[model samples]
Target chain A: MKDKTSKNQVLLKRQDFLKGMVAAPLVIAGLPNSAGAKPSASDAGNNVSYLFDSTKCIGCRSCTSACNQINDAELFSHDRPLDLSERSRTAIRVFLDDTKDKGTFIKRQCMHCLHPACVSACPVKAMRIDEKTGIVYNDPSVCIGCRYCMVACPFDIIQFEWDKKFPKIIKCTMCKETNLKTRGITACVDVCPSGALIFGTRKKLLAEAKKRIKKNPKKYVPKVYGEKDGGGTNILYIAGKDFDELGFPKNLGDESPAVITESIQAIYSWFIAPVVAFFLLFIPVSKNFKKVAGEENEG
Target chain B: MKKSEGSLAQQPLFGKIALAFVLLGLIIFLIRFFIGLGPTTNMSAGFPWGIWIAIDVVVGTAIGTGGFLMAILIYVFNKGSYHPLIRSAVMTSAFGYSIAGLSVIIDLGRWWNFYTLLLPWRWNTHSVLFEVAICILAYTIVLWLEFTPVLHEKGEDSGIMKIGFIKSIVNKLNEKKDGANKLLIVVITLGILLPIMHQSSLGTMMAIAKTKLHPLWHTPFLPILFLISIGFMGYSVVAIEALYSSFYLKRKYEVTMLRNLAPLTAALAVIWIAIRFFSLLSEGKAGLMSSSGTLSTYFWLEIIAVIIGTILMIAVKFSSSPRFIFISALFLIFGASLYRINVYIIGYNPGSNYNYVPSVMETMGTFALISAEFLLYLLFLRVLPILPAEHK
Candidate 1:
């Protein structure tokens, strides 16, 4: 792109330089591999995890009700929230099979991944992740609600308060600021009557999930969901039905999306790349400015 | 500004019509503060960003790329023959970026908290939006300052320098003040550096979206692709602006200048198209172009527009016809603009079942922003020394 801007009326027209400009993308294509140190997802043993077993879940909406009630403490009613929204921290959905014969009850909330994209996507650090618990939370006051987090979330979990005069972003924080602060457990986990939802340290819950899968190989899916999904979610799932049918996003490989973005951004660490580029531009610009000024003086 | 660029006895008759759109925009722009985006925009949680982002901010900044490119040619490369076009291009860049910044403020849900961008602790270096916001903020100031010499010229002509306060400010900022103008190099250099960083980051912003943006638009080379596309877009915008002034203002067209520029503009379009298709093929996503329902139609529509624009430029490479150059550049801009629209809006597949179409107010909002840009630009042209004195 720069070569073509040469002053020679024939400079850009010179086939050799235009060829170089056209092929400039080759330099950029080499960036991803050559840019920076690649950091893999964090593996913290002490991080908290939520285990939701779809096969063990009842049709009752108690967990969803409790989540809404806990988050919205002013409310006395615990009526079931139909879906996850600005106020609803969690919801349970039914994915029915063919012929409407059988349905799997699935719970939905933020994945709170070890490398949550929302935390990375946030321009203002409004989306914050707990170092110990990996609880991804949104600070409403700091958010300049660009909703880039909603765009970046692989699960489409981050919700926006779209209808408000001054909107705020909403998503699951695993009650890190509320129930977990006092009760030492999430509201949904406390209210789940069927043992469908359980809470423990990330490493222990993952071990438990693997043990269950190993003990009941025929009954459970052989894989522990989220063990590698999107570089491992703190919210682990074990379901009998296909994850695609269970309404879980498919093929979120071991790499989190943030890994690529973070690495790319690191190319300009402390704004080194841009500063170098400015110097490169300066050398030519100042030289040319001298000539332009000299000509003006002569005129 | 030492002499006017063929000023009329009064402002052009069409200014009132442009002012009409500006007024409409002002009303809607005011309404956004009182009302919520839910009622005004068709955006839901499913589709968070709509035309305000795709058109106003993304495409809007691209329209200014021509100024950056022109500055590189005239100031950096010593293209004195190209000097006549510099002031107008810089002026366009200033207005384009100021509008984009304004659009961003209106689009934000908590725009007042944007001051957090200045806070070092809140700066997320990993976030592409952070880089984009910082660069745009800096560059908008650079652009206005780059065009400050014209303001100094205009102020002298209009006798506004009679005011002591303004005279002091203008004297300090004036570039024509002999040896003192050496400092102009920094502002000029920054103007080029900022665009390269922010425009590429605009593309990289979507790279993190991964599967959310359809495979056709999402590539590891997004930053590179965006930077190249801006190359063609930059040239075409300058060409179109000049050709437009020639026709309406009845000034002599920079036909020879534009004719010489034609081949480079065509080459850039070709470069962009080549990288785009190569990325599509190498990524094995070319298959999606044909199979992905209406998405395929949009993909072809965008690609075909650039191809046609390329052909038009090649056809007129040797010709001196102003009409042909105008048409070719217009097609090129349309294609380049649609390419951005496709990338930011159409080709972006948040997921199946998540759909968006800009509501009436949202559509008006985008039009209003563009209209406001033009309205202000027309006013500047009338008052300031943007266009150069035409040769006999």
Candidate 2:
């Protein structure tokens, strides 16, 4: 009787093992496509771009004051006018070479990358790029203030409202909901005296940047700052000095950080790996189950 | 299994310390809510994530991985003899995850808007954090359900029903015990699946910070590394908890089962170290180890801790001794936690200008959170059938 029962237990275990193997693949098939289903390319065409020429900038803090006034933001606790914070939407940082004679003023704000890492990092669609205008915006209503966007952003543009009871992410939106909506131009671009800042379609900005570089190769850095940096940014810069010397991130490849991780996720979420893992794990489970059953029958 | 595990001990000293910590933490939390994150935390724009994320959520959840590890061993691997360890591990995991969830709420700048995380329509499919959040939420619920059987078992065996209200609830729970047990198969499977997804997703969360994170700790293989380390930490936590319980509660030590687990723990630790070094070499980042910096120091410390812990785990003499096992478990937990801290904090360099250190209140808050977890754990162990019944 014991031998027959043990034989039946072994058969039951094999059947259970087979059932687990079959179930794993079926479960995998039901999972949503691992590749992000969003349309990636459509938003680029409509994106408004900025052209900031450091050669034309005169170290005047007018644009900084203009941005602060327009945004109705506060001064940073440290009271540094050049630093970007929740209270300061934009800043013009003055960089001097070792000689201290050559000073370059660079305007810094949100790059508004075409493939924004902040948008990809936000778990709740609080950070999003507007499909129509291609402006990156943060919705405080839905934001949990996880600060994941701040970490994901290579440019370090997103500032937090650390002092506020109900904090929100503060980043340049190209005056999408503010000055641009009513005045047809960003506050800083509209207020620049030296024509250093220009607001237009990304195509026009790129052409303008290229024309400047081609016309005066010696005067410009020979490359548009955001054209291919971090998978192309809406905000472009034509700096007289090397970007790395002026506090810009160095060695940033053209690929967005989001693409790197998302692709890995896609490969793993393809279902085959997980199914194989389940099958591998099931073997021990089946053997142990049979042994226990056989032992029970003997007892 | 249905019998009482043991009588509750008069743990006055522990109870007092836990209450004091909880009270202090509550006071700090009130200050934090009123004053905002800036005053209470060392978080800046450059250093947005602090210990709240690194210790509470990341390390806390890693420690909580005990339940899933045991589930994999018992349900997926079908090692039924390990069943005695499952309930206690599950309880610990449930508490760990619950504290992590609460820490997230406390850490969020806009805590009121936290419900947006639950709205499926707002979910970002591309975000790894989204997967983590959803999985954690689901797993916490599943863990609680898995724990109900313990409560039911306790209610059925313990006859001291002094309070009418309490007695009625126990009766209801006891009445549903059979149905709940039947449903446990599905719950256990889910409990196994959810942790695999989230624990790795936690690592993926750090992967997005490519340039900011130091090369020593940052790799594209972060998800895999995290999963393996978490598995090692999970077994270590189980070992520590088992040994501690046996010593303090005066119960029989499951030394033989724990001794059997030593090889598996050591093997996982070995695999983790191999993968970590191999991935670092493959990324051409092995040169960074010699850099004279805080990050390099922490990185070497993490590596040393793991090596020593693994060596101890595999050594026959050390693995056999309860004291050595406990010490090794501590080292493994420390190594795993430091790895997470290095990944999230030490290795992260937003810029030369930004610096952060946890404030006094932030430290107190973390302490309180841990103390509360211990208090709850003690309460559950006393009242629930979490431990195996002592043979009279």
Candidate 3:
């Protein structure tokens, strides 16, 4: 937006010349490149894999209990969690399928996406994606409690401590520190006797998910979970019924949130280039400005 | 400041009234410290930010862009004609920023540790807030230093020529004043660079939360939108301040320069609308813009205000009408302000679960910050030759 002080006046010759020289290329660079646009969901190896096959599971809340115990989360009164809450890091929400006439439990936690928006959105690198494990982590000590990460998370997995005078952001770390590292299994994965939840590398899990769908197309939902949802999550799921019936958000592509912001920010950063171009054009504009000023003085 | 001009220190009625309101606000602000954000503000977990963050800091910084815009025009661009406006604009920018700095203290739950941003080793490069904090701090210092010439002029005019204790201190500081002022151009450059970096980063701060913000506002272009609007707001503030001063002092308006300034304002407004238009269409949220009930109303209001402002400005371009110009410029400011508030809070939707409406104290705190700014502006212009000399 240009400043509004000079409404009716013509652009000073020098101003016009300088503006044209600097602004023309900016407009050119700002043009959208439709040809080079890529699919939103390709994983750059940032994902934490989880497998949940409803057919193999029972309706036990042991996973939820174990998660709470390991994380020292708030204790819910009821044995079963029908909803996802701030304090509850992970929960199994049940979905009743009308067409298939079956009950499936969907475990919800951080998707740990390949292009995690929280990590990208964090201005101070407070949220980081561990290269080795693909775990999305937040350093509380560095967090200013801005809560922008909470808004960026598509799954609404992140929460803030609003009541605290100085609060820390809270989210699931995938129990990687305890279960996967030392115990060789996650709290939820270890405790699930029904083989409902399986944990492994995203690549291995994705292949296994595809294999299950291929072996029995009728039994599975034909689509492998996390294959391309919001740029693909590390967690994969194979349900006996349709995924949407089990409360999965449908139509989420593998597109990373960071891409959109980067494109715009990239355009603004192009300010330096246009400015340099203006400098290149400066000699002519400066000459024109002096000439105009001299003419005005003569008149 | 000269003996011939007599004492300009006499307070105007408006200044006294403005000071009273400022004191009231300060008292209310004191109450906020004793209590907490919870007792004072409408902020919630769902909406962690409120008007203070959006209006007092974000919009305030943009409105303060006058100094930067003028600096670029005069110093960098070497359009020396614009230099006369720089001092007054810089004074306004200083007050705007200082108030914003105070608001930051109010906004922070753990403000004592704000100095943590200054720690070299503790730097968090990934944190946008950290960047904003450091830049604002440095810029405030720059603003005061830039206005040192006004302080020297004040001392000289007061007839403290003898090198007494305080006179000697002032003289020592003012020694080789031209060299000192020339050496400080680096600070001026930072003043221009820092606002650009931090103000845009303010918008980038929101870009991180893609899902939380309404689709109407949730674009990668948020930073650009913020930057442009600030550019527009900067001029609007200058226009407002100049006009108000002219009216109060009963001096002839700098009509020619102001007329030129109007077109720039219009251009920025048009640019902002264009980007918003494309961003919405490309993002595939145009339908939601019109269909979303409450959000749609706010969206329309923003659009209508901008359009009216644009038309008014264009009309003024063809022919000048003071009333129309004032009305249109006012509309432009209203539209820009609403758009900013909308992007930060109104357009945001956490979930259907929670709601936020600012409490009285929160509103009072914001008012208090503004009052302080107005009060300081009044005091500075009186004591310092910050305002340009009225044309004979």
Candidate 4:
């Protein structure tokens, strides 16, 4: 009886292994065409962009105050004009230079990368980049206030309202809201006496940025900030000194961080495949136990 | 010895208290909806993720490692004798993950938009949390589906007396037990697959925080380390749950099954320690321990916990006492939780200027969550046929 049972178990094992081998490819083939099911590209808005030249910025808090007024937001501190507080969407950060050049001002806000980590990190379709202008914007209604976007931004440009009863994220939308809703241009650009912050298309700013660098090769650093950094951000920066001296993160690559991790995670998450594979493998592997249970039931 | 006829109607004292506690926690959670996380939590710009992300969701899901342990037994090891424990372990997993889901809803600032996470358009397949969320959600459904037969069996016998209308349907379904058992094999197999994917994805979440997380915990081998630790912790949770159930229910201990569990737990611990050292050496982060002034303390603390935890389990090879096994399992549990706490809280640093301390209320809320889970587990085992009948 034992020998006969052992033979039946061997047959069962062989059948299962064969079945699993046949089923494996079919399972992979049946997987939803993940690429085809991607989100619609129709939400792209106009390609409005920002050109920030650090040498021209006077560090005068005029742009910061203008952004607050344009956005109709409150100030964190009324004692002095706030510099990029939770309420202030954008401002100039001072990077004191001790070399031949005097101190320079660096504008701080979202880079609006061609491929953004914040948009990818938002569990909801809350954060998205406009296809037309490539402006990264957040829909507050859809935002769960997870602040994952803050962690994911390499530039550290995104700020949150920590003190508010119902806090929302604060970021430089390139005055897209004001420009799109009302015919008024970006408040920061409108108030800039030195023309430090310019509002235009990214293509125009890139051309303008290149012209300035070519005219005075000795005046600016060899690198163009946001040109190809983290997959080409819309907010371009031209500086007179080394980028890091002006508080920029050094050594960030052009490749989007989200792109690298997605393929690896997606493969393993297909739930139906592995579970089916396991059972096909197990039914034969546990034949001895099954036979024993079957015989015991008969007894 | 006295034997009592098992009826689903008899409610234990623990059951009533558990229900009351869940009710109270729900009320507090409702209040959290009107107000924001700022009022209820000590969350700041410096510390955006606090106890909710770390202890309640991360640690809570890890504690549900029992199902994984059972899966390894019944499927991988081909230990069919351990079948009875599968349903109960799965039920625990179901409840544990479902509560993690609930904690997530409570934690979100914009809870209304949570459906976006489920929307097909919003799936960020590359994201670790996305993978974790999808897997955990699917696993919760799979777990309850797998445990339904246990309910149907009990309902067939006494569901009429406890709840009248449900019995007739259960009586009809009981006759189809053979077909259902075949379906159960697929469900149980999913129980095994979901954890392996999601638990590793959980580790992948911290791996992406390479810039923010401390160097000691942040290594490329982080996912592998997380996988090993979760498997070890899962076995430990199974041991802890079984031991607790044995004590409270006054039933004969399943020493034979529990004995086999130690070797697997020990093996995973050894693997966990090996990778921890290898990754640190290769990454050249060995020097960070001495260089870091304050974080150095936590580095040593994590190292000691893993080392001492593995050593305790090793000692049990010579000593056969259940107490030693329990203590060793506790060490493993402590080690795993510390690893999570260290990665999420102690090691994470956004910048130098800001400081944050978790408010007392945040800690209390975490305590309430844990208390509530334990209370339900007690209530569930008594009311539902969660525990197996004592062997005659």
For residues A101-131, write the lDDT of model 4, one tens digit per residue: 6678877767787767777666676787665
RMSD of each: 8.3, 9.7, 9.5, 10.1
Can you give the DockQ of every candidate in the order shown? Answer: 0.51, 0.36, 0.14, 0.21
Per-residue lDDT tens digits of candidate 2, residues A97-153?
899988999888999887788898999999998765668889998999989999999
Which scores greater on DockQ, model 2 or model 4? Answer: 2
State how far residue A217 of model 1 sits from its true place (Å). 2.0
iRMSD for every model:
1.6, 3.5, 5.5, 4.4
DockQ score for model 4: 0.21
- Tell me, per candidate, how large a share of the native contacts it keeps: 0.74, 0.68, 0.17, 0.30
Writing each residue's lDDT as its tens digit, candidate 1 over B17-89 gives 5667678877876777887888888887667889999999999999988889888787777786777787778
Q: Report how far off residue B243 is in candidate 3 (Å).
A: 1.9
What tens-digit string does per-residue lDDT give for candidate 1 at A1-299? Answer: 22322342244234323333342344455443322212233444567888998889987988878877888766436667656777776888888888799888889899988777888889999998765566889888888988889888888788887787887788888988778998999988988999999999878888888888888887788777788788778899998877877766655567788866765665665665667778988998888887876775575
Model 1 CAPRI rating:
medium
Clashing pairs in 2: none
Over 4 Å off in model 2, which ranges?
A: A1-43, A73-80, A267-299, B1-11, B156-179, B316-319
Q: What is the lDDT of residue A135 in candidate 1?
A: 81
Model 3 lDDT per residue over B1-392, tens place:
11243223233665566667777777776666666566667776567678888889887777777887776666566666655577778989988888888887877655555555566666534345556777788888888777766666777646434536646646766777556644456556666677777777778777655656777877767777877877766776777776655554555666566667778788888998999898899878889977989999999899889878877776766655445566777888788788888888888776665677777877777777776787677666656676666762
RMSD of candidate 4 to the truth, in angstroms, is 10.1
Task: Report the number of the highest-lDDT candidate.
Answer: 2
Which should have the higher lDDT, number 3 or number 4? Answer: 4
Measured with DockQ on alpha carbons, how good is candidate 2?
0.36
For all predicted structures, in order, the TM-scores are 0.91, 0.88, 0.78, 0.83
Alpha-carbon shift of residue A149 in model 1 (angstroms):
1.1
